[model samples]
Target: MDFIQQKDLSCFNTLGLKSWAKNYISLCNETDLKGVLGLLKSGAPYFILGGGSNVVLSEQIDQIVVHNQLKGINLVQESASEWLVEAAAGEIWHDFVVYCIQQGWYGLENLALIPGTVGAAPVQNIGAYGVELKDRLDSVLAYDPLTQTERVFNNGQCCFAYRDSLFKHEEGKGLIITAVRFRLPKQWTPVLSYPDLQQYESLQPGLTAQAILEAVCDIRRRKLPDPKVTGNAGSFFKNPVIPAQQYWPLKQQFPDLVAYEQPNDCYKLAAGWMIDQCGWKGRQLGNAGVHARQALVIINTGKACAADITAIAKAIANDVMNKFGVLLEPEPVFVGAGY
Candidate 1:
């Protein structure tokens, strides 16, 4: 465990935003968690951080920042067709995916290049190219702060809904994720379901997990700005899922309202398309603006405060709601006072 005071948090977050944590502690293993929790119990507010990819710290944090750095990976079981792999919370998400691919495991290739940690993956149910983390997750090991006990939750117990999971819900609040377990397939069955991925397949049909991973990484690199360079999260808002009836009227009006029908009577609409049509794709407001290539992402050109970014996000959401009658919800967790 490493502890520091008045830490400069610029390097901790992927966005490279200039921020400070009053106190910061990095836990290298679960054994260090008790002392960290004791610090948190001292009555100061605390924030649990993983890879710092999916978060925006608007202001200097006055509370303790517990940087989850637990790391390890083990193959618990392997059969003729399947393997169960377990990863500690602090493992880098993309690295873990690459490791699985190197070991001949499939299912996580489509999610390659996503920034964050294994623990945070389950919280957001991270997905890409028609592949979601829930599809491969076996269970999650989390520590209940209130109970002071470690509990394991299965897939069904996670209550995954689109990009949401139990960790995002009220009941699962105050629980810190310690580790994640995944079931990977030995036999390759590539998922080329998304439009872009399918198009890639048309060019080269028999895509392996490695091929899919490379393609997804290339696509993401071209589409989303690297947070290290641009100081931005991958996507600012989630694609709005509206009722089918509501979607039909908008589709009739625009004729190109990109939508996908869900299992229920709902329709998922592309947030980027809406923002782009509203003429906000490359629009800049001060240091904050929509990414020129991807409208769903908001970037900090330089020295943009969290409030400035949040203001732009609100403006985009308002315009989309006014024009399409759909509300855009933020994908990243907003921390600090101003959010």
Candidate 2:
């Protein structure tokens, strides 16, 4: 592995935060794990970066940064009821969704246009519109660098939750996802449970998977700013899930609360709505600003650093908490303590 010294990574992260790495390497091949393991064994600290759509980078990282650029996609099998599709870790998530749709496989349309790589999806159990990755996942192929061996974990093994999976835990943290296999249903139905999709389908009357995919893309494009044009990490915070006991009183207090009742008697409160209610929509602190249309997004207006992003995020979170008593948690991973 050829490690570049002092690599500039402003363009590497979706937030466009100015950052520098003491050592950096782009892993384009799975076989390069041998070299990566050697470097790790040499007592050097390291960080694994995927599509860079879900992270906040610090100004300086005094460690090795391994960028995942691995890529491939294959149809493993075609059953009477479903299709088994597999994609490499570094494959663009939106591209893979389009490929599955092109093959006539359905079930992932609701998650269309989500940024990041296939590998990073399972880490956060990426979801949008009305569906989640766990709903279509067959299994995940991961490499254990310490053991120098690979293992395949089924959907259940993933321990998927709202915007989370086993991959975020300690045991699965070091496991490098190589590829992801999805079981997309052939006899598909539209997931129109989300209010946006529900209204869309009501307007369209008869909807197909392709149409749903297009609608999802349109909805996302309108809500999320392109990382290239205006740097942003999509949704900045996760929707807070509160117990039913607590939700009722809050609901009574704020009748216009936007929330979805969970299957487990909890309520997933919309973080964006709460932030907007707190008078934070389109607000700015330093170089960071809340996206005017989508209060969930914190954007880099111009060369914003992680500090600028954090400052705005902290202010919004604090305001939301003070008003609603719900603590907001950031969805993106912070790469350094400085942020």
Candidate 3:
């Protein structure tokens, strides 16, 4: 294993926060993971890093950092109704979505342009445009460092909820995801229920998966900054899901409050809308600022550190909470103390 020491990770994470890993190991093959996992099991602290899209490092990391680099995408099976596609943990998520379209596979079009790796997808139950990862996930293959064994968790076993999964739970803390397999349906259906995609209905006459993918990409491009150009980890806060009864009274007060009804009579309120109402949108605090286009995003304007970003996010959350009774929770995982 080519383990490096004292590696700077400022560029690795999407937020571009200044951070350093005390010891770093890049695992390009499955075999490379055994040694790293063994070390972690034997009382060595470690953090498994994927595409570094959904994390914010507020301080230098003292543990060993294992960067998952395993790469592969293969068609596992095909039938009249479904296509089983498996991708390595390190495969770029958008690239994989594009590949599926090229292969004539559908069902992932609505999830296009989501940042992060296949491994990270299940961890966060990534969702966008009225679709979530758990909607098409077949199973997740992960390695349990404590047990020194590989475990395959089917969709139900993953315990997927809104922006959450078993991987984020206590029992899954020591597990390292190796790969993800998605079951795409052969019967294609357009998911234009979202208002943005609904506007593209005129193109629905002969719209293909590529067309939907392109439309979604265009929407994301307009709404979000390219992480390469502006440092950010996509949506900074998860949409707060409040009970329908509670949301009704709040809705009566704030007629412009954006929310969507869920299966269990709960309403997923727009965190961005509330933040914008709190006057955080397009506003800056030091080097970090809320995105002008989307209040859900907190951007690193220039020379923004992890502290700058977290402090601004907290202020926004606090403001929203005070204005409304709902507490806004951050979406990105914090990798350091007091963030």
Candidate 4:
């Protein structure tokens, strides 16, 4: 296994924050994965990085960073009702979604254009267009360094709940995800539950799975800034899911509050709407700023440092919390010191 020492990772992460790792390794296959784990210095801090899309590198890291680059896609199972496709952990998520659509597998179309890798998808329980990764995930193959054993977790075992999974828990830590299997239903139908998608259906008429995929890609492109053009990790905050008791009174006070009803009478308030209402949209704090068009995103404007980005985010969160009395949780994992 080849390892680079004191490697700079400014460009590796979508946020484009400057940081360095004490040691780094990029694995291309299962063999490489197992081999490197055994070589890692015991008791030393280590981090498993996917596409680096959902992480914030706040300072220089002393840990060993393992970059997952394993790649493959196979049709593992088939039945009259569904098809099971397994993709390697390192496969680009958006590309995999497109591949599934081309192969007539339809469920992942709603998750198109989501940045990051297949492995990171289940960890974050990634969601968009009214569809979540948990909806189609069959199982995940992960290697736990604790026992030095490989394990499989079914969808239920994953314990998915709104951008969260077992992979984010203490027990699941040190487990390197190897591959993810998705169960795409053959008797598929377009998920048009989201208002924007519903609007597309009314205007376009007769939307196919591919059409939905395209529409989602287009919608995301218009809504999100391209990371290549502007450094960002997509939505900076999770939509706050508040209890109905509080939501009802808050709704009366802020009539234009954008919120959606969840199961069990909870309400998911739009984080972007609240930030925008706090007068943060298109505003900049030093080199970091809230995206002008989408208040949910924080952007690195040219010379922004990790501190600059975090300061902007803290200000936004503070303002929103002060105004609405709802604490806004950030989406990206903050790495390094003083985070």
RMSD of each: 1.6, 1.6, 1.2, 1.4
Candidate 4 C-alpha lDDT tens digits along 169-265: 8888678899999999998877888888888743366667898988898899989999999999999999999999999999999999999998998
lDDT of 2 by residue, 1-339 (tens): 667999999989988899998889887885676677666765566778898898998899886898877899999998888889999999999998998888888888888889899999999999987788898999999877667678999999999998898988888977778899999887788788888877764338667888998988888888789988999999989999999999999999999999988888999999999999999989888999998899999999997888888888888989998999999999998887544
Query: Taking the tens digit of each residue's C-alpha lDDT, what string does model 1 give over 1-339?
Result: 689998888777776667898888888875689877666554556778999998888568886788898999999999998999999999999999999999888889999999999999999999999999999999999887556778999999999987899998777856778999999987768888789987764338555788888999989999999888898888889999999889889999999889888978999999999999999998898778888999998998888767777889899999999998899999988778544
For all predicted structures, in order, the TM-scores are: 0.96, 0.96, 0.97, 0.97
State which candidate, 2 or 4, has the greater lDDT.
4
Worst 10 residues of 2 by lDDT: 198-207
Q: Candidate 2: which stretches are off by over 4 Å?
A: 201-206
Local error of candidate 3 at residue 189 (angstroms): 1.6
Judged by whole-model lDDT over C-alpha atoms, candidate 3 comes out at: 0.89
| Candidate 1 lDDT score relative to the true structure | 0.86
Tell me the lDDT of model 2 at 215: 86
